[model samples]
Target: MAAASGDNPSKLFAMPAIVADRRDDGSILIRSTTPLKASARCVGDWLEHWARQAPDRIFLGERASIETPWSTVSYRDARGIVRRAASWILAKGLSTERPLVILSDNGIDHALLALAAQHVGVPSAAISPAYSLMSKDFDKLKSMIALLDPGAIYVASTKPFAAALAAIAPLHRATIVSGNPDDADALSFRTIAATPESSEVATAFAAVTPETIAKFLFTSGSTGTPKAVINTQLMLTSSQQAKAQTWTFLEQAGEELIILDWLPWSHTFGANHNFNLVLRNGGTLYVDGGKPAPGLFATSLANLRSVVPTVYFNVPRGFDMLIAALRTDDELRRKFFEGTKFAFYAGAALPQNLWDALEELSLQTVGRRLPMVSAWGSTETSPLATDCHFLAKRSGNIGVPIPGTELKLVPSGDKLEVRVRGPNVTPGYWKAPDLTAAAFDDEGFYKIGDAVTFADPDRPELGLFFDGRVAEDFKLNSGTWVSVGTLRVAGIAALAPLAQDIVITGHGRDEVRFLVFPNLAACRALAGLADNADAREAIGHAAVRSAIGQGLARLKAQGGHSSGHATRALLLAEPASVDGGEITDKGYINQRAVLTRRAAAVAVLEDDGASEPIGCAG
Candidate 1:
């Protein structure tokens, strides 16, 4: 049910609809549509149709190191994998609701485990592989499992996940299932995958209905406890339909898309949503666990350099590194962009410079500039909502809602908040009815607490751009409101040439200052700047000058120098972390945590030490 419709030419045109109680302050109320019974068919149960129409086509992927470039895990094979995986999971003491959990690098095993969960009408919580291997943040991993109450947790045997999983096992309601074939305590994902092909997977799993729980994706939990959002079978199915419908509107047939992502499986971007969109139409997926920085991830990139994907999805940081590589390396550039058709970015804000660079490179390689677009959604919305399609228009706005989605702008004090309701949208937060009740308006429109504006007034079909998070915006002591989200994003872009990022200070303060982090690479490139004493002095000098210029420019851009955005000072040093005593895994700069850890830094911010801007992750 769409909350916003294309009928009203003033509010919404021939696109997605929005129905909200109109307010005087340039705002419209978006209300949810009445219930309608639609097909319960879900994307995870992909076997029924694919088995009949194109049983020979490749539906899932085989790893790069394997002998086959990709396996034709036909409709039949997919079903068999599901059946075997379901059987194996059930045999390992898993129940319908209490399902098998996977925390592995993205691969076919995910598809198998996912479908098996769908078949049995169970919701497999796909935990992030990064949490298990990459030690950026560890405590969150244990908390996520405790919330899910999974019957079994699965991990790759070769990886160090077993040890990590073991550390967190005491908190889990499930048994541990190792992905490795050699592990004595684990069920071999490979051996279970060897089950003979069968059509029974469809028929056997047909009992799943619209009400059946499809997935329980955990929110990124940046500021609070990790929330388990319920995803139903119909929710996923409708999202796929909406995605396929949106793709078809662009006049493109089914594409042989290949995506390489390491954004982590725990997030809906890499797990529940992106993968579902790919499988909706039978396409190839190259599971790349590569990192943009040098080391093992580099080796993975070297291996993937040969397969030029038709569809590429990467984060803003990763795109910067990839573009630099494409510009410098001829072989990589050719292989990477040769077959590349479209690119999508997410996980963070895409900087204007990076966006400009990508447009230029795409033009050079493809002879016609390819669209660099993205989408906006969360696990709360089943991770499918507004997609930024540059095909119709190329402004920076995130695209309109999928066919079934309804979005409205609920008027707030000097801000318009977003709200949506549709099959793709999740019902509510798990075991938090109070949260669920508070989450939606009277008309049942699920509130998305982000600020938005209609930048393109001429075309209502084009959706709005993000203004800021409602809570993240606050009033300075001077009574001037500060949008921290917008400010942080702009600060990162403004200092792109020098600083990596900045954390804005505006909590009960008269003006906002930044803790800036200088770009290590750029600092190295500055003349006379090295790790030596004289070099360090040179680096600090150049950095202070560059930072001062940026700060002044930032002040001017925000209007007058009196605006909250005007920088008061800058710290030449990077923020301390867990080891150094500053930042956390969520990229959260614990103000109190940092202040307690480094009284000197707090004193500096307070101007008791020096007028230095401490670098911080916003």
Candidate 2:
């Protein structure tokens, strides 16, 4: 039998057809015609080889224009372009080790150079160009820019970005592309690709092998400055290999597999999770030029409606918005999931209701619901660690360890911390050896930090569920420990209708309290308020929300934690902000940051007017 994730784990060893040569690391090297040497090659190396092998296949780029039947740059052409650009950069004495920085939004040229750079051993660092300028930390961004001292900077030929880069990278090695040219900088991204590098890029890509540093990506965590994560070509290659059994994604016959993605390029899910999958399997990706929650779904529905992607990946909010559109517009729903093979949701926990809605839509169109997978991983794990298959109900569990991975649950403070050891795991945070050492155990498995409860391991139905962050859970005054992850999931599920976001309170004292973010969408609908009518809608929304507020209060009253819990006070206004440190880029709340920022809310929960936080609850 094929190694679909639906197989029983106990029977896996007996099935020799699926299992391959066993490794010392408790992982089986499954059989594949994909070159064994190419197994761990960096992305650039992989692509360069593919370019030579299958030059005609589509490569890294958007389609010619809106009306073109074919979209994006094909692989063969992508190599040629990268080679030209690589020659331009290299001619300027660009070193392979000191990365080239991409300070722009997601686009075709952005992807091409990133992969191409990896082929030649020069790691590419793509930071959120938007996040760099005019923020609370200009130096913080400058420090990131300084991290690589980027020998060269590649800017999208577009406006604000082109204008922004001019201000951001003054006196730095700069080049411009005519494709999105807003400013007259040094060179064009596409025009430079037209520059000749026939011998240069081909020579570079062949040398970048398993150990070559593919990417030098950074992740901003709750604790400190954004630490860099070093990824090897092997890690990127293995990541692609691991997904072979989970998706028939690579099984498309001849037509290019199309993908329209709006997820941020910095995040693992947005970058490697979707992009790498499409790249490895020889698929075409359409960079959704719009942002999400609203901008993306409409474009995505339009793109997927006709093109029919081999796979689709969206966040929970994206799915929610799509459901709303689908419920009202059947044609959109039918077209949205039309030729879709499988779907994936990441970044946040998807409620059962949202998953149910997606399933209903899929079942209506295709007669059988397509599998919508949820993957779990950290930046340290090169992003995707575990992915659940869609054979059964959407359990929201992050499925089994992929082919080259080994998992363990180490009992830590008050919970068992999930750990994994695999090639996919980074070589540790860049320049943070001590931090990396502490991140793992004596056994060398990287400690995942979050607490997780072990589920079925053999048949492993819902592979494993994510508990809250190791730091989020706390105990009551009575000393009964409460898991923030569990409480949040339960609380959100209970208050799904009225919930947008909820911050559980009362850490040291009595029962747990919360600062909730209301479902403004639901509020708007219930209050009959239009989007732009903030003033007029607020008057009506206040009354409608107040009534719904009482319902939420009652809902929280019933859904207590461990015991009969009550939310001492919940003030609903203002969405959480990433810039303000209320949340991470991944949308995971910084509990400590929230606690410090909303000191008054916590104070109100403890002792209302007389406490240190008199004006806390807003």
| Prediction-by-prediction clash tally | 22, 20
- Tell me the TM-score of model 1: 0.83
- Model 1 clash tally, residue pairs: 22
| Candidate 1 residue lDDT tens string, 518-540 | 55555555543554434235436
Q: How many backbone collisions does model 2 have?
A: 20
lDDT of 1: 0.61
Candidate 2, residues 1-618, lDDT tens digits: the string is 123222232222221112234446543222222221325456765566667766886654444334445455667888777777777666655564456777676778788777656656787777765454435545446556656667767666545554455445753553434346445655666566666775776677667678777777777544456777887777777877776545534544234567777776776777877788777766667776544443344555555554556567777666766677778877766766665656778776676777787777777775666566677887778776766643435546766566667666655665767777788888877667898888887878887777665454343434667777787778788988777766665555555555655677877777776666666666666667775445335423555546544644554566545423444436456666555557654455666777777786666657754322112111
Cα lDDT of all candidates, in order? 0.61, 0.63
Q: Model 2: what TM-score?
A: 0.85
Tell me the lDDT of model 2 at 36: 18
